[model samples]
Target: MTTEPCVAAPVRRGVAWHTPLSVAVLCAAVWLAHSHWPLLRGGAGRLAAADQGWLLLGATATLATWASAALAQQGAVPRRLPGARLVAAQFAASAANHVLPAGVGASAVNLRFLMRCGLPAARSASALAVKAAAAALVRVALIAVLAPACPGVVRLPGVSPTGAAVVAATAAGLVLLLCGPLRPRCRRALAAVGGDLRAVHARPGRAAALWGGSLAFAALHALVLVAVARSVELPLPPARVALLYVAASTAAALLPTPGGLGSLDAALVLALAAAGAPGATAASTVLGYRLLTVWLPLVPGLLVLGVLVRRRAL
Candidate 1:
């Protein structure tokens, strides 16, 4: 029933701070959308004539992605969330994810939900962190497993200096997390996360749900991409297409774009091209993938988000 004190502080600010930040994020999303509009148009034109059955299948898989996310989120915590409401929260979380950078919006929503479900703020955050870490690990593992199966699917593109610098900075940050001087609360958070990890794994069902749901989430997303490619008559095999999705999505994660908008599109297009699809097919594939995954469901997702908020479920 109570919101986090930190969360309440910002809410009390009455959009004074939120307005500018929201506008900035919205502007960035718009710029990226505008730049990528041509591909969407081209993809739409092709999809207009695409196979409806496969497109429908892609849509089904996209829906499955939300379910998988819900399962994974539930697995992260010990307490049970009402199944129907939990899934709806995840649906709303997906919409929130598109509005904010990285996943701040989604995390805020889920954190509030977990707290309302009777967890303390620290445990709710730790649960979220554990779910995120498990999902990320599963994704990388899938990429490694699939990359070898499809020999040429991933390539060592020449790394630019900027990319190298980014990698170095990331490595430095990781090292700092391990050895840096920390405040008492920071140290406690690390302890809590570690404890949460062990606690989740100690329960067989939780462990299975955590890992299994994470795997399913990644697989469902890749399946959606594969089905979209098929709908547009792209010639790649499903396995190869799935490989490309995992790799592209993993790479896109580094960019921190909302819902992986621009970065994901670009990486996916490049990945498909590397997989030997024709230019139009590759473009159409990316376009169709985004359409099913992002555009088509955006409005409904937002509406669901609003309903959840009105109900105080998020």
Candidate 2:
């Protein structure tokens, strides 16, 4: 009888916190949209003057990205997931992704969905790690293939001795920090991920789906940027734009910003400018890209998230 109150107390506390967290997430979304309204408004005006056909192409590519993501996610685990729900979860996860740094929100949403699908927690986490590793590998591969086609599009910045030392010191510090308290846990997690990775690769169909979906997701994103550039009539070649998009996105991953917001925007603008686009055109291309990828789908994505939660799908 005494344990009942103790258990009920935690449940009540969880309910209390969950309500506020939901409210906070909604409020943050509104605030973010409100803050970016001016930029979106101005970008809309610019897009209004641009080529609608290219913009439509960009939007279509944007829609295709979510499907690619769902495919990659399914390939991460061996279990069969409901196709429609998986796609819906990915769509909702994209919206949630913008609310937190370094893909936390999206990861959380997917993690929950995976758990609800009946996978053990450890396996589910390993699946996520596998998916991320596949995505990273695919991004690097794309960059390597595309970079050669667009000579001089990406130039290596020379790091001074002091800057190199600082970077090395920062990396060493992070390594030591992580190694201290989390070493054992990290080791166990890595082992689990390695096991899952091997199990996944043992099946040729799963391996193909994982790599193919990852490649498609990255390619589609690059295509969206290329289409946006075309819409704005940016002078850069399509190949060059695609190369710059992949390279810039890879570099921006180092920044822990929510959905690569500021980091990606800045990297892309600079990349386009370096590739010979006029400053105004470069900015316009980024704005249009963001409009299709982030802002336009945000509200609807959130609505889907709410429905998923209500239906207990996530």
Superposed on all Cα atoms, the candidates' RMSDs to the truth, in angstroms, are 5.2, 5.7
Write the residue-wise lDDT of candidate 2 on 1-314 in tens digits: 01111011112334434445556657766887899899879889999999999999999999999999999988888767778888999999999988789899899999988887877789889999999999999988888898888878777899999999999999999899779988899999999999878887888777887898899999999999999999888998898899999999999988999899999999999988977899989999998998999998887887787777656666
> Best lDDT goes to which candidate?
2
TM-score of each: 0.83, 0.90
Error of 2 at 256 (Å): 1.5
The TM-score of candidate 2 is 0.90
- 259, model 2: CA deviation in Å? 0.6
> Can you write out model 1's per-residue Cα lDDT over 76-150, one digit (the tens) per residue?
876667788889878878877876778887898799877767677889999999999999999889988988888
Q: In TM-score terms, which candidate is top?
A: 2
Residue pairs clashing in model 2 are none
